[model samples]
Target: MSLLSTQHTLQAYYLGLFGRAADPDGLNYWLSQLESGTLALDDALMLMANSDEFSERLQLPADDDWLAQVYPAYFGRPVDAEGGGYWSSLAAQGVSAPVLLQSIMASATGADREALDATTSIARFYSQQVSPERYDPAQTLIQEGLRSNEALYAELAAMDEQFDALTVMEVGESLEGRPLYSASVGSGPRKLMIVTQQHGDEPTGTEAAMLLLEWLSGDSPEAQWLRSEISLTVMPRVNPDGFERWVQLASGEASPDTTIDPRRNSADIDLNRTWDSSETLDLALIPEALAVRQEIARFQPDLILDYHNQNNYINAAGELETISILWPTNDLIDDQVTATAQQAAVALAQGVAEFDYGFLSLFPGGDTPQIARNGLAIDGVPTLLIEQRGLEEMELIAYEGLAVNYNALSSALILEGLMSMIGVITELGSGGLTDIDPALALQIPDRGERIQYQDIYTLSDERIDKEGMPTETELQPEVVGVSAAVLDDALAA
Candidate 1:
């Protein structure tokens, strides 16, 4: 057979396995990947993997390092020594490249990690969005995805100690005993405590918080100002166990269909709700909550900011919302605190708008004092909760819907709010965060606060007609386009 004919046959066979015929474009992509190091053929494994570059296919199956092939395919970087050893061990025990790739994709890699290793994922989705000529190895990160706690801590520890204003310490541990860390910056007169991801599954806040850490650690004027004027304490991931649970959910070990949100720790108590609860007050039931509550007592922050993700039932405009800040319910909230938060919220929203970046709004309705934002508010510390967009929706809004990645924009807005709040305290001489405009906060729709938004379904990233059927357009075609029929319906799976 001709070389072209041989390629066509192989492409046809693979597509046939999926109950679909070959698209010439997909076949072309497949063939190009063969040259770009995508493992298109089982027989082409390079046994002597250490060479890094295989001048000629070895045609022998000796040291087939599935890890080597997949590391670059996924992370846009080679496997580290430890990773290479681990996966090479699996390959030595008889795993093939295809099997290893399947396992990697199935494990905790999730959509965000997969987005980085874009060539192997969602070619069809990007075909319309990103130009084929500009294909980079790792195409995306964030967009409703999360960084693993290990990955996050590694990055944090690796940051250079550039200033005395920054200090990293452990505040407490999760129910499963994962160390909870806090990064404290600044020694200013006022204190601002920011806690993120009290609910493990809510990871966008943690990502945004990391950006704040990076910014504050820098030599920028803003960083220097924040360092000298306000003491900032941030616990990026408060619910480590729940965050791990989110990783498990992505890996298919846990199901999102659970009755209670899997964001609960091992004891199955909602971490956010545990605050101020009778049981948690005495460190009775929720140890995780106690750890943070104790810290809050010691910190006595003038303002507390909690970050989170509200997911898709929100973001009604089919665009990435910059952030939604929630103030304490006015009922029991300190008038001064509310004024400060309201002033900060107004400035935060204005900053995002000024950049022409993401849209910012407020939590329109009354606050529920049970959640961490309101729960912490009860302590007389002003509080604001920031809800960033979820994954698929964030991807559409950040990657496809808008200009730059929403993360930088998100980080900036968060920093602005923190700065404004703390700045208010610093200028206490100018009369502290007095007030912005109650009318301004009222302008933001109570879209997410309403109970109806809670009890309903929201559309996924894929295109749907008025009848709600999948349209030709798909945000992640590889993830969703198979027929709805079960693969093995007889098993009731």
Candidate 2:
């Protein structure tokens, strides 16, 4: 095969095994490996198949079920009983997944090869078109694995040292003695506090928050402009103890030493539910919530963006929601504060909607005063809830939908959300955030229906047809400045 053929084959492997288009640097490195005879084609394929990205992206059991799931992805059909038995026997005989994948791909007949070719074409298009600035290699690295508590701390420290505009501070400590760190950048009077990973399992926000910090702290014209307009603060990971537990469980390294419920703190308290203004920060247990509350009181931000991820859900258009937003819905919240949050919601929806991949929805949340969105608003601090599509949920959704393109989708979703957030922050800093009509948030379609993991693909078409399409007017907010396109250019600049 020529170099082009070699590249195409590798790109297909990237999409097949990693669920993403190969980055230019990685592609070049592997090409060199092949050209220099450092690794043969089969060896290269197995190396990629054995990678952490492959394992994490698939998360499939290394057994008959793995074959069952993977066969349909490449061949566009379920594994027949005979094939399953054969694969299972091989698996039992200690044939590694990498070897099995190689064997399976090698065994593909005409139609299977054609289906794979089509998928490879999709990867090629994306790889060719993906914006280097938008889909940075650093962003990809962040998504590869969950960062350890110490690693997160070190990264923030390094950012603080590297960027003159960025500062890192230890605000408090987690119940498990992990430092509760907060990063701050920019110096404008209009303050915005971003809190993410409040739910341990919801991690896209943490990744996006770091990327946002990297962007904001750089010397780009937009970053400089925004810095002159808004003092930004971010608590990237709020529930460190819970996130630690979650990471352990996810990596199959569950320790007998820690709590099992990653959604809660070491004290087994739902940190989100602990955010009641009526209760003192030190009341009862879970110092993570207290640390957040303390930071909020100290920052006294004009707006707060709480980021999270929700279970799989389809919007009114019958498309999977890329992200959902909700403002303070508690009756106790001041009307003006709630209205401001509504305006922010409109800004966020408008920002994300500019990207064709994103489907905005009004996250279905109750008006309980304990959750951060409601509780913070009750205290007269405007807060908006942003729930991105859950990572684990999307993995299962993609499997059910037979979508081998999920890694690309997942990467786009995070990058888009991060850019949208940056745009929203720009608007907030420039006072353009409140210029949008708050009532437009009401028009943002409701999160249409919950799609259970096992049946999302099966019912997707039916739901889409029955639910009808979202009107063009839905969430069409009249904004003043800082649109997603403008921000996209700014980010690249």
Score every model by TM-score.
0.55, 0.66
Best candidate (score: TM-score):
2
Model 1 residue 414 CA deviation (Å) reads 9.6
Q: Which portions of model 1 show Cα errors greater than 4 Å?
A: 1-145, 160-163, 254-260, 277-284, 313-322, 364-367, 391-432, 435-439, 448-493
User: What's the TM for model 2?
Assistant: 0.66
The lDDT of each candidate is 0.50, 0.67
Residue range with the least summed lDDT across 10 consecutive positions in model 1: 482-491
**In candidate 1, how many Å is residue 238 off?**
0.4
